[model samples]
Target chain A: MASQTRQWLLTNPPVADIKLSGDDATFSLVTKELPPVGPNQALVKTLYLSNDPAQRTWIQKDQDPERLYLPPVQKDTPMKAFGICEVVQSEAENLKKGDLVLTEANWTEYSVQDAAALRPVQPDPEHGIKPTHFLGSLGFTGMTAYWGLVDVVRTTASDTVVVSGAAGATGSMVVQIAKHLVGCKRIIGIAGSDEKCRWVESLGADTCINYKSKSFKEDLIKATEGYVEVYYDNVGGEILDLMLTRMKRHGRIAACGAISNYNNGNEKQISNWNEVIFNRIEIRGLIVLDAMPKMGEIMETLSKGVKDGKIKMTEESETIVKSKFEDIPSTWMMLFQGGNQGKLITQLV
Target chain B: MASQTRQWLLTNPPVADIKLSGDDATFSLVTKELPPVGPNQALVKTLYLSNDPAQRTWIQKDQDPERLYLPPVQKDTPMKAFGICEVVQSEAENLKKGDLVLTEANWTEYSVQDAAALRPVQPDPEHGIKPTHFLGSLGFTGMTAYWGLVDVVRTTASDTVVVSGAAGATGSMVVQIAKHLVGCKRIIGIAGSDEKCRWVESLGADTCINYKSKSFKEDLIKATEGYVEVYYDNVGGEILDLMLTRMKRHGRIAACGAISNYNNGNEKQISNWNEVIFNRIEIRGLIVLDAMPKMGEIMETLSKGVKDGKIKMTEESETIVKSKFEDIPSTWMMLFQGGNQGKLITQLV
Candidate 1:
């Protein structure tokens, strides 16, 4: 193993105008010697880094440190991320050298993580599922989609579902699950561009509407004529407002994220508060951590679905925007800009 | 039997400035001959009419006709209200003459309603609980409080419950139940005035804050030091927004009414929506009709509680704003103006 390890450290928080300069003060790439793995810990080499919008929220300077859902990434510390990793050295019985695992070990070429914090990736060659699926489809994002749809929104085949941020990592899983697995008759995806909309349509969504198009409202209204029963909201703000207007009585909204408000000082506001009350809608703000107790069962079902070919997970590596370790700072910005089509993966090795 | 009957009719819908003029175009008092009872129907006399905030929402001229929870009162027709009534004549086996009952019959001195729609009142002379308990503590408002608090908010003894519109009919019941029955650790009531705040305190709330006071924010913070675990919201607006800030992680909000939005074109927008996401809050909009299937059992439990003296319902009839039959139009206005203390009732007979 190399004696020197390189990691991206959060230096300063990003402002409203979130752009990375060549020598961006927000993040710094530094090389240091790998720390010795202690007992119950393993040294991991990150294979694929997962890019999530939640990364932006974690680095907010003004957020109350005590109230954050998870601890914020401290200044001059390696930013926390979920990634597919290979155990390079181990002192724990659960993990061994060359064993692939999923962990909060990324933005780094090498990491020393507690073995207990890692989840082993189940290799199912019969299904042709890659180990990276554990970072996206069969992982936290999939767990979020499953619980949000089945448990929170209580989706049924008879219902018409609407999903915002439909081409993104988490939202795309929700769109496919609602359509194919849950058997929802009509699944509509609201995305930003026609290219993203096309990607969502290719994943078996009934229809995709580009929210940026001039005919967005008309197209959405025409597409969801029966009204939305379940709205899996990955992007909140105006898209959520539009969905609120088109919701039927007793509609359920799974508030997954408000990516639109992440970098903007002027947070997107939802004005259709009346529709929620008048229609007796239930809006639940979900954090995947709340669904952790059901992880074992969730992973089992997800694995079976992938193996049985009941769940369609895009495996074309070309879809995952690959970047070198040095490009981590600029590449992370792609999450906010919607420049990354599928999951954005940074390959270290 | 009396051949003539006096009833209140809705003449026109109210405007942004919702006021009932003495001879208001919104309501008319008319004398009409009682219609004959049909099969499975009973001719009932309205003993006490319920003046609920929902009445204001039901009569909104701009509301979609199909979206009303219950059928809206037609122009020149008897305004619908819940009431404690006496069955004067019945063609149905379940109802008989002189049977004290609960009904969706009000504003009118007499109504011909389906027997199935009436819930017979349980008179407990032993506990000195009157049949009027059916309209307040044992009625739809009571059911709304019960389900909203117990079922929806899932209050526990460990919870710090805060209620808005604390002295209003439905809110008072919620305040009492969350404090007394559920035994929440800290119970705070948010009311509009000191007098209303005092009334809420008398019902065993740990503290009461007058939202109209300049020290409202400081007082609320001091009262709920541990933060609000469950918020039963009856008046939605700035008060709702204020509560959003003080909510703990996984806090539940039972949205029973948004009375503040009824009169103004400006609907209350919750600006601290990020708190909901970060704290993982769940806000459920409730309409009592959704709990109809649990009505029989809900009324039974409430009636028994009143009879057993386990539930303390303030029976100072003076606190109940009672008006003569012709004052129905003016009496309804008392609801919006916070003119009623315990419950607003119109005595038609």
Candidate 2:
């Protein structure tokens, strides 16, 4: 029997709100024969894929490579998805069959990728790190959180930190890190729903506000008391704009992800620019991959934190949607709402 | 002799653009009896008042003390004007008669103020320094330029710096400092007219574009080529918004003043916030007064720079309009246009 491959291809980049299906679908499901593994290449079967909020921005229309840190996903190609894959066949010296590795498995059932691109993952759990954790706390999601709060914002016991998207994947990690590990004086979380806020608070946030509430701006103001020393911003739009006015002089902002503005792109909605000057605040944007050289260092701290029970384990925070390849787009959309509060990932076996 | 003081009072703050005198006047000329000097106070006659673009923001309406670096000017008060003043009478041990001091002389011919608020200016010229040079180079105007370029953005020889309001007082200083002092390889300036651009270029800026011209944005794009390493922003809003996109990785911006939005208050204009993150840029706002502890040190370098001809001598750059105290408001409005292409001051005697 001829081997088969199933993958989702980005057919068009969205102009405004994203479309995953129908006539205006940004992505399409395609079936083809699995390509044979060539020199320095490995054939792999994707087990789990990251359904990232930033993934939508990666497929933005007319993405000027100059503007975007990562180039726009090429139209009519497999939509970029970084995931854990099991090596089915290998022609590279470093890899063998049945070995699980982390690479761009994408939204595909089987992929032939450069062996150099793959990093070998222990097939078995090491100190409670599951292979799916590579898509969760042990991966870029965790790395982003660690970098944003610890390295970027440099939160301390003296700081009053406010984190937007407190319930999402990277955000969830940041909340736990700032509160449980870093021991910040106050860690305020901004989430979409009251339940999500509650969950975020349980993770270690001092107080969490529902941004969708009628009195969100008022509540956030009251919560922060106009003394936000450090702001780890995950959702970029109105919340980020409001936070600008509330920051203390010389405040540090870790511009993580603008999840809310992922579709339209965060535009001219910000009004408190004068505050950025008045307060002498610093806003720094980061691509977590830029810190790949620090990966060993990050993993050491993150792994130790997890092992020491300072940071929550994958099973505690993991929110996975076991869905088919056809449902990847819809599954990705579901996480946008506050309903999916924990570390979001798609179990794409 | 019972003397009368001629002064300008901020009667109302503007809603949009400023109105100096009209049915909706923001300022009014008034004459009052000069109050007696009290203990720890000095009576002074204003010699020269700074016609600053930022002076307008100090008079902005409903300014929250929390939002503004300096408190807003209270309505029905002598409008704030920092200037060179002749000490006519003194009750403080630190001040004496005939001494010239740099202080809040207001838009008044004569006024009594706290002696501690005044810094005694040298009565005689030293190293070619004049009383007017205190307002030009040794004052807060020049201190703002030095702190912004040397400390805030920390521009190096390799930097491509863009300065807005390139013909204005602080901007003119920045153009000279970034070029002759810092020796930055390329410095582009944005002014409001062809004449002002030429003046800015003459002040050591590599090229100066007329922001009012039809090809302004295009010319700016072609000039910087999306590699603005450091931006000394004297004018904010659209130019700053555009610069957010044009920044290189880890670009730095020194937010000295936003003169263009001084009346409008730089609202809802910034759209390229994502670029602030994508490029890992850092923007810092400065209130030059915040660095007052370093004043003696700043004056030392500025004085030396002038003496060595590295920075322009006061006579070479001072744009003094000999006018009555009542003309302070109108003269200030004139500086907003690019015509006043030097260190602006109203020579009030």
What TM-score does each of the candidates earn? 0.84, 0.95
Give a tens-digit lDDT track for model 2, residues B72-114.
8889998887899988988999888889999988888888889
Candidate 2: C-alpha lDDT: 0.83
lDDT of 1 by residue, A1-349 (tens): 6567898888877656555555657788899988788999999888888888888889887676656689888888998898889999899998889999988886889888888998888767767788877777888888988988888778999988899888887888888788778889889998889988988888878899999999999999899886778889887777877788888888889988888877776453655666676678888888889888988898888787777777676563224656788888777787887776656666654
- Highest-scoring model, TM-score: 2
Give the lDDT of residue B219 in candidate 1.
92
* Docking quality level of the chain pair in candidate 1: acceptable
Off by over 4 Å in 2: A123-128, A314-316, B91-96, B123-128, B314-316
Candidate number achieving the greatest DockQ relative to the actual structure: 2
| Model 2 lDDT, residue A259, Cα | 76
Which residue pairs overlap in candidate 2's backbone? A285-B277
Compared with the true structure, all predictions reach lDDT values of 0.80, 0.83
Task: For candidate 1, give the lDDT of residue A283.
Answer: 89
Query: Against the true two-chain complex, what DockQ does each candidate achieve?
Result: 0.34, 0.65
